[model samples]
Target: MKFTKILAAIVTTAALFSTSVASHADALTDRAKSGKPIRIGFAHEIPWAYPGDKNEPLGFANAIAVGVLKSMGYTNIEPVVTDWGGLIPGLQADRFDIITGGMYITGKRCKNVAFAEPMGKFGNAFIVKKGNPLGIHTYKDIKDKDATMVTVAGYVNVDEALKEGVPENKIMQVPSNTEMLAAVRAGRADAGAGTYFDARNLSESAPNEIEPTDPASLPEWTNNWVAIAFKKEDQDFLKAYNAAQAKYLGTPEMLEAVGKFQYTKAQLPGDAKADWICANR
Candidate 1:
């Protein structure tokens, strides 16, 4: 009868484990459907997620997230602003449920967090003096002229530059686009690097101060799409978030919402799977 009791205990334990797993899954779904606000991390990139005049979050990512979540029965969404470099860490630390910055879904980043889906795909553009004094249009151009290329810290452009043979000394990593532009404007760096959309916005915002050159096609870089990042373990949350994203991303409403940002159809990502991007890389 001792053996019989031990077998019964094992069965009971297995049943309890199964119930616990289901409870956690139900909790995640219920918590999301609850009216409680979900926090999303944002950085100060224009047209992505940046603080407005009243320090309120406003940008493409923020708007998209707010719209989708509200329709998903969520009434509140909070934007947790942080530096670009801090986005992933903040999410991992539970400072936010997800990061809504236009962070690219590179293979390197996939190891750290689970990505929902592609939000937008874009190429890189360079910011230079109004008249293109140094003719710095590409990483190769910067390398050829031995000019300094300023990029935001944690941006992929730095890797592209280094791979293109831009010397370490010729690259300055700043904390934000503001600092990169400042370095270029003050003649501290020969040029600034960022996404094409960012370059266009910067040029329009400061017309006389800088001009955005046509995007330079870096051989080592492919067109990368950005996605919302969540902790790797948040499978239930990630799945729900992707469902919400599917309802809005690449839709006509999506275009209208982000139109003011000047993104083009060519820059929009097709329904390509993120897993493919991660695996091929």
Candidate 2:
């Protein structure tokens, strides 16, 4: 009788464990269909995915995610805010189902996470004081003048500057564009390098304090494309999201969603495959 009881207990425990494993496997697909809240991670990059006045996260990436997910019946989206460096690590730990911010897709990142099709494309721009005090229109100017410039800690802007012969001592790595702009304003940095959208948003808020230098005039700073990031195991979720993205991108609704940040149709990425981008990067 005691032996029978033990066997029954073991079977029950095994069944429970199996059920838990199945639920874990289902994750976004099952949860999304069942009306569970989808968690997305984002950094506080201006006009990308930052908290608005109401403390609700609103920005270009957030808008796109909301539109696509809502169209697919996944209305319950929970935003997980983190710093720039924490985005990938948080996603790997299952802290969020997706990184909704404009994470740039590169060969290195491709090995770690699967990326959706390219959504936004941008080149590096500089945030300088109103009158361009240092006459810093390009990275070369920063290098030539031996002026210090600020860039976000994890962004490729720092790399762009380094490649242009801007020494390490001349580059200050801050955490956000807000601080970078502040660094320039405080004379801690001669300029701040970031995405064109970032410069536009920052300058618009304080037009008298700063302005964005035209990146189009630079010869070496080619445009870089950005895409939504997903875990490698979420193949099914990626497919569903991509299908929705195809329908949502370049539509009137898409423009309306991101237009508040001054995103133009020209900023939309072309039909370049992620693999090609990864290799070319």
lDDT of 1: 0.81
Query: What is the C-alpha local distance difference test score of candidate 2?
Result: 0.85
Please write out the lDDT profile of model 1 over residues 1-281, one tens digit for every residue: 99999999999999999998878774336556665668878899988888888877778777777767766777666778899999988987888887888888878888998987887777888899899999987888999998989999888888778878999888999999888888889999989998887788878878998999887455535467887787787888778878888877777887787777665566667877789877754
| Residue ranges of candidate 1 with Cα displaced over 4 Å | 1-18, 26-30, 33-35
**Cα lDDT computed for each candidate against the true fold:** 0.81, 0.85
In terms of lDDT, the best-performing candidate is 2
Count clashing residue pairs per candidate.
0, 0
Query: Which pairs clash in the backbone of model 1?
Result: none
Off by over 4 Å in 2: 1-26
Model 1 worst lDDT window (10 residues): 26-35
lDDT (10s digit) by residue, model 2, range 173-201: 98877788899989999988888888887
